[model samples]
Target: MKNTTTPPKIVALALLVFVGAVMLGYGVSRMSAQEPQGNPVTGGLLYDKWWTVTGADAPVGDHPLWATQSTNTRTGADTWRCKECHGWDYKGADGAYGSGSHFTGFPGILAIKGQPVADIVAALKGSTNPDHDFSAVLDGQALLDLAVFVSESLIDTAPLVNADKTATGDAARGQAFFAMCTACHGPQGNAIYFDSFEDPLVIGSLSSDNPWEFIHKARYGQPTFLAMPALYTLGLADSDVGDVLAYAQSLPGEPALSGGGLLYDKWWTVTGADAPTENHPLWATQSTNTRTGADTWRCKECHGWDYKGADGAYGSGSHFTGFPGILDATSKSSEELLAWLNGEANPDHDFSVVVDEMALDALVAFIQQEMFDISMYVNEDGTVAGDADAGRSLYAGTCARCHGADGKIYNFGSEDKPEYVGTLAVDNPWEVFHKVAVGQPGAPMPGALALGWTPQQIADVVAFAQTLPVE
Candidate 1:
């Protein structure tokens, strides 16, 4: 009779125990079902590993694409691998190796990252290219693994890159974070020379030109380099990468110059000046004066400070060229200046040749640095005389060889519209100083550096040029 109440409590306790066991079993089953099916990290590793095309065997026929595309026919097992054709960055035709002999114009596979695993597997299994079928090369599991990694891991870089080819991030913060990258890349990030050309893929140049590739490489680690750690593994945030890009973009791209040396050995090739006139005395002296593809050979022959021909120093002399002066050009705008170079004002003054892109840049820099007004010194009468005694000594050293002791050897001016070195010297000392310092681009006139002359020496030369005849 006392045990009847205890039996009811025991039954309730048994029921609770049974319910707890059932709940534990269901939880374990759910976890087992949700576990990762494939290893994507391993798949990324397999994707980078290359496969040989023929593998130590001689090719039977001329490679079908070789005659038109590439001369490289000695195919290895790894030669035709996807990674070999497309870069690790997955920008095949549009990216790093877009141009040159290796250009295949193949679209990048990065865009297919989020595609279904079945489609990616099909692409690998002879569905894309019969010649490129890799089904036999890799197992099904390996293919599935690769597809999983690509689908999950690949990133788009469009948002990070700017129109100016620079990274849109905080440069100052990036500078602080870029220290780890500077070891192999140098402090300036231009240390690692690649290819036979010894061309350094500098941080500044890469960041400026291709920030997306930079970020991908930075996060994934380079495929070939085992020592390099994946930044993703270190848990670096997107903002950190952006900061690095911004910092890299701030570095200098071009190397420092050796004080403006002649870019090309030939001065004529350096500056695209007008062609020399045949009747000019200077043209008769050398074969260079006659042969002309570009107009980079006649800078000094025209636009003499002493604009008068035969009336001043450059007229009847060895240096004389009966060419019109650029007396009116000082008032012209930049557009007009460019037009003059293109031969709009004068048919014989075309400058397209000899001046390549870099040369044009240098020329533009020169023009921007030198052009100025010189109307104050020149008089209406054309006779110029600020300081003849000071001018006489300067002329003897720098000008006497071309103009003669009297400054009347080459008459640069005619009777009607007279111009002479003396007149220009008195009138436009500023123009004379500019020419003397820069050494008229295409002309043989010695640069002030070559002449070992200072600004004072150039000014002194201008003073002497002013004493020469204007008419």
Candidate 2:
């Protein structure tokens, strides 16, 4: 009893238990944190990209890091992103970025995972690495959030994804999970295009080539696209994210268009194309549609919105012009349609001098593949045969933004002789159907058909719109 000094092993064991208890207690405290924690997903997004998150322009020139190296060859916004220097792997050049277009001679920050969160925050603020200052671009909270993500949230992603960028998770589960993504990304991830006309990238393409980058962006909602929600913030676990990634990677890739449908709707807005300096040549041929300039240049103007030409919407109205519709011509061979477009069949109908072969082909493809007859949905009495209930909902989301809630927003005619959307839908539904399907010429109204709305859905909205204020 007098020589009762604790053994060295007992002391070590007690210390181990003490450390474990402290860590467990700390973990519980963080889990039960009463104050609002910053959005680490947004932090990750900021790490991958700061300007997009902040909705600011690229930091008005080079980032501080760009002066440090000249070999990487990136500039402006690319240099400002934390991952540009650190990396999507968080390993910077020391890992996946060690060799590639992204290779920067910067060291990876993965070693800082277990480092003190405060220390990480300080380093980002340039307290340690003088050249790595991010305070100019990010606020304190953003910095702390970024540090919290780097120190506590970043998981090792290599094992979760294969070299081919396929996720190791269950794709089936991801498919079900994809429903949440579709509200914005769309059913096929084609709702939004990510790049320019010549080089386009959609969500499918982005997820396929750079699974790591996709994972990073997916976890954090896109900075510029504020509507996109970060799944991580929605309580998804790492495996859950991997599942979504797996499904996204498996999806097909299709560029929305090089400018086909829009050109079909109205051609001048695109680059290298000049707006009509004079009324369209066809304008002199008819005076029913009183508008001039680009409006006259639109294909929908000559071919009624119904594509029925003098046979449909514009058949008897003041807007009528003695032009033929494209319905019959649609059955013509591509060569025949191309010939028609090139003025081989109709000299006055020629667009050959205005648009090049590629543009002309796109227009032809649109006419051949997309232009549909409206007679199926529009009864002769002008009553829409679509489900009005479904149409009401579509109207709220897509149409009500321009038209008022009661659908009386725009009076496409004079006050004494008004032409409300309801008037158009109820009295001239054939016009409504064509306009809705192809999009209104000269207006930025979306072509419901091109936007993936079903014919029935377009009918529904048109029917519902008929119930709006006609007076």
Candidate 3:
């Protein structure tokens, strides 16, 4: 008892050492178990617009944090999005948003990568600043997902991407990877125009000018464009995304052959071109594709889905018109085709006033270079002329992704008249063949021709598809 009382300072020092050892061990454990396996793609979308991702009601009024910053004129729910403040490149005011319509002086979270996950999580929860608190809206797991994405997925893209925003990966191998994307983006990635009317922004432009933004969209997908799938959810490696960027950047910057296929299919819907005040001058010529208004105006209606009017699918059916096939037009020059579209060759065929110069040129290019005869592969009765067994193999490689192994994942038609590859192959082989060759009109559906699938291979696929399900 006397010895214990004499060593009070020594006892205090020993206690401090034990406490330090325990704390050090805990810190080491935290390091070992840092980032979780949450999806960084989802995190990016959440950063873009959490309410849109979560399907939550828009937050009432402006963001509470808006009071602190007056530089950004945007108000209401937009002020609360993480990317609105932190920026898409994850550098806030330091990166692309340094002085755009999105400018906000907020510091980006990119510098916090490899930092303690707990600290990041704490910061998200407002441990560092009460003004930054997100716990009131985001639950624990949401906060954790954001934290993990920031800590582990925020890559140093400067090494992988150039100052011009082009990626530094292998583009050759990336071409094969791009097949998964062709269904929606088209072969050249020009299916959709994202920006304004005056300056259309296609995927190639987006990829070359802003690869970080491209990768972010390619990884997580555009929240606004739900049809575009996230490659990350499909288990693509990080390198695969980079490779895709490299390949996508290599695609042509301008729209090319078959670029106007959708407009040809349904110009009214595809171009959003205002309907003519008067019925088409040619509407009274022949009315087999007995549709009204905009439907009648689709080039596919009069010319045929097979692009061979009177000699193919629309030859003698309810969809028929007495119009000549476009196959012969393919041999014509661009000047000849332009004349045909501008009323010089055929007054009724005039589209100069309906579509702009670029659009007219695309249509002309499609007619001059992309048109082909597919009647040999498809029968009048919708029977395909290829080996069904070989088609089964083609289906495994391509169609299985969205159509499933048995081809019933998506119901393209209404529930009452359910559509599937089998049904289309059996009932409308010409339509299927056209879609396979040129991609679906108004959609980036896979074009067999672009992916190097021969007409025979497409026939084989149709043969296999016919064996699937009628209902």
Provide the global lDDT of candidate 1 against the true structure. Answer: 0.51
- Structural RMSD, model 1: 26.7
The residue-level lDDT of candidate 1 at 469 comes to 66
Local distance difference test values of all predictions, in order: 0.51, 0.72, 0.72
Better of 2 and 3 by TM-score: 3
Candidate with best TM-score: 3
Model 1: per-residue Cα lDDT over 138-217, one tens digit each: 76666776677677776555455675566777888776556545423445655332221113345677667667657766
Top-down TM-score ranking: 3, 2, 1
Once fitted onto the true fold, the runs of candidate 2 whose alpha carbons sit more than 4 angstroms away are 1-36, 255-259, 268-281, 287-292, 314-322, 346-358, 378-383, 392-453, 464-471
State residue 217's C-alpha deviation in candidate 3, in Å. 3.6
lDDT of 3 by residue, 21-95 (tens): 455446545764874444455676777787787777878788767888788999988888887888767888787
Worst 10 residues of 3 by lDDT: 1-10
Per-residue lDDT tens digits for candidate 2, residues 1-471, read 111112344335334434654564475469647764555666787887787777777776678778877778887778888888888878887767888888878888778887887898889888887877888778887887788888877867877788666789888888766665543455566555565433446778888877888887777767665445566655568898888888887776764433565576567664336787778776898877788777787787788667788888678767688988888877788899898888998788788888778778877777777777677888766777788877776776557645767877778989899988988788878767766765554443546664577777778889998898888
- Cα lDDT of candidate 2 equals 0.72
The pairs that clash in candidate 3 are 183-444
lDDT at position 235, candidate 3: 56
